[model samples]
Target: MESNLKWLRSCDLLIQNAYVFESALCRFVQKDVAVKDGLIVDVDKALALDSQKTLDGSGKYLIPGLVDIHMHIESSMTWPGAFYKQALRWGTTTLVADPHEIANVAGLEGIHEMISNALSLDIFFGIPSSVPSTREDLETTGGILDEGEVSELLKDPHMRCLGEVMNFNDLKQEDSKTRRLIQLCKQMRPDFLIEGHCPKLTGQDLSIYLAAGVDADHTHQTPASILEKAAKGMFLEIQDKSVTLENVQTLVTHALYDHFCFVTDDCMADKLYAKGHLNEVVKKAMAYGMPQTQAIYCATYTPARRMHLDDRGMIAPGKKADLVLLRDIASWQIEAVFKDGKPIASYPIPEASFSLSLYHSIHLDPLTEEIFQLHGYQGKAVQANVMVIEPHSTFTHRVIESIPIINGQIAYEKVGLNLVMVFERYGKNGQHAFGFVRNALQSSAALATSWAHDHHNLMVMGNDAKKMCKIANQVIACQGGYGIVDDHGQAMVHLPVGGIISDGPLAVTASELEEVTRRMRQAGYVHDHPIMSFATLSLPVSPELKITDAGLIDCRRQQIIPCIERVLTDEDND
Candidate 1:
């Protein structure tokens, strides 16, 4: 080893005994990688060089550290630091987080708060392009992200790209604040990505969405739409639900693999820990006939490129020495992870310090069981717009359900029907909305969550008004969190941080959620993740129809409509 060597071969770390995937193509070859001061100095011929530290790769195959280009850290319901603790162990070195969930409540300040919390990890941000997501009038969000705030936030180096451009219809309508924000982001980071959430959009509508410079969509997709989107030069950000065996085969078989990337856009803590992060996506892809190498490529280089992060996605000379070592590419067992040329070491998860305002996020007046009551005016049979949940998907189906008003109220005491209610927890107004969710739960259980999509409103669902009130009040009592009330008394997971992410260790939070799920299931609540069944009920963007704090939105029409068709008789009117 010579100090004055031209290539600086006297490195800080040298990783030997390995086969490295050189690029996005995940080509494997025998190589000795050299790292100097957190950056790779040479790939080959460094075998004989002396270094301060060395990691014997043994029988492992080295791949670039996984990069998840699209996700909302809040969705995991864990603090960002806790997320890093788990995700890093599963081979994720970098994350392109969208803090839009918190931003919806606290605006730019919320984004900054998330940034401050994640100061220790490899976290980049996509400025929440659609904070309120869409029409603020419909959803009572506490803060707003207009052009000015977004432009100011874009100045931060961490703002790698714009967050999900949710309002696809606005792009075609050529109106609203979203237009100016998109233009500003385009001007700011012309080459960076603009993520999207356009599901069921095709042909002209898809073209229109792409034309607005929104380059990717992470929503659920079918084979036809995936092919169409890829054909239009748009990147497909696939998640767990969207990555089916058929879709995976179509993407790899057509050689459209490079245009696709894997993302855990909204994984819960249990899912994040129990199931691997991007590693799970890679395994699922491989099981679907995708070669292991291509799966690795989609998880690493493709997402890095989409986020304009070219410096760290490859194990090449002059690249950042962030990498993942696996015992075998087939089994996908993570042996070790290294960031900045140092092996990841297990330690206690770091706690996030926040300002006073963030400690108690939910602000609302008390509510009685009366608020959950639904009635057809004058006690008449009416045709009502009911929210119908498709199995295993967040997308809701709008159905014209018939309601027979009994006595003075229209109640859903039936087995398959449940009362769905949303309260504006931000206290923007005392206004709340009520509707019936049919076929959501099989056992008629009451579950309440303050984790409603972009806007974290308080929501409760069940056939039991007393139980619904109990759950909702329990969630409120926790300051802001999730709660379920059944024969088991009450179970709540406290997420004091914005009422979305729990401020506890990932393990604790994951375990608690698992317990809550088990109890809810035991209580006869039959749905995949009953909490999400209520949580996503208020998201304005997901397909078909969705409910907001204002009322039931005909998502396609992008407006509030009466849940029931009020048929009035002359005698009843008088």
Candidate 2:
């Protein structure tokens, strides 16, 4: 809040000037704006002034600073600080972030890091609710949080609401733990907000979910879904990844814009740089035929209203000064960005070089010997059920089938590997659980993430029992990170950021991830980086299928089902 009078005196500042748009029916341009005490003191036709800094608004527009309703900073593949620097440069002055990835793996420590990062910048934190996403005991997580933890999180100054509560089916079933956590948040903050994750929920199930006090949803797959949720008073978050310009066109044409707001639930660093942030969403919406004012409203007022951020969604007196100055409305080019009435970003961009320092693992040690023991199998072939997940969607697909059981052990199948096993890394017990899956991890090598979906667990995916055990140990040895090893027992790549992020620059991490993905492809794996895919697979709240340490999960049934038939096969012994 330092004063900038050196640049404000001697005819230094311009008078009132603004390019105004309202209600999709009116547009006006004026030249009169005065800055003092870091707030727009006045805006009118003219003001007699001796200013030191004067900016010409010959033909430009002034709008409120953009707000991103929902986003995951972990998806940026960069640390929080680095993401903030780059994001601010693009006019994202305020962001609502869900640190579910870190919370899953590192538990409260992860959430603490998120809070610290948010405090360090102009941002808000939405505490994650579903950790160890599913109640699967077969997996080992970084940590766990019950009602007590949620209560503590809610007390934070930055805590806005309980993050996306993924276990909707469990909520429907009246699960005690789930209910208690939600109730705890309510007690902590009477009008507490809870985000939703019911992708295909409808009819009675949807009603029950809405009744639980969940206020918003980012998983709307269709206009019908948005309409259904809106009918129940849920704020629909329009996603950039799932809802593109083509589909946005349909929503705008249908005039279903009021109940919706824009959010980039997961935009990678590369895409954020190329396409822009909240501003991009606004521009795309306009190009798709959404009225410019409507687009601006969706990007600003609507989300601010939903979040209850009453202090700064408009450009009037008494409102916190957060504004975006644009060169034009058509191209949506940002000219300058301001926060609290002081220009924070302008032309002549600085070189973008970001770095992360990770102290190598010193407290953890690698297992030089085999740590897993298997039982209940006999020969070379066996039957098993599998789990599958679609791309860019929250729900998973569970399938049951028969496959090869090699050497008295279940083999990792490439074309249709149905079941995969998970071992707890923190426990010497080496408890092994299996589940059915499809559409990812086309390789036999194990893929682990401390960044597992809802609950950060030591999630390992591989068909080979021996390699799965080995990779799990390696991940544990690194204390946390992602590791992929070949079917022939060869190490491919390792990025040990609490088993979640890479302690390197975004470009470096992206390059290493590219190499790991390349190796997966070379190893006969057909899917993309199965590493990032596993993060969502453990989320019990999404839908269809997922696995925790418990075993193969039937999310709808809210219980773990066996992946194999009762009969034992010869291959189970390997």
Best by TM-score: 1
The Cα local distance difference test for each model comes to: 0.81, 0.64
User: CA RMSD for every model?
Assistant: 2.5, 5.3
Runs in model 1 deviating more than 4 A are: 346-350, 375-377, 523-525, 567-574
Deviation from native of the Cα of residue 369 in model 2, angstroms: 8.9
Compared with the true structure, what per-residue lDDT tens digits does model 2 show for residues 1-574?
2344533432324534567433233344565666655455555566666655666665777766677868888776666666666676666777888887776555677678666655656678788877756554534455577777777888887877788877765576666667788888888788777887767888887888888887688875676776677777777888764466656765676666667788877766555655577777777767777777777777777777777887666665455567677888768777877766666744222232222322232133443323332344665554565666666555667665555555554554644553454545444345546665676556556665545555555666665656766776776766565567775544433445545554456556555556665665665555433455666677655567677666666777677777776444453553
Q: Estimate each model's TM-score.
A: 0.95, 0.81
RMSD of 1: 2.5
lDDT score for candidate 1 against the true structure:
0.81
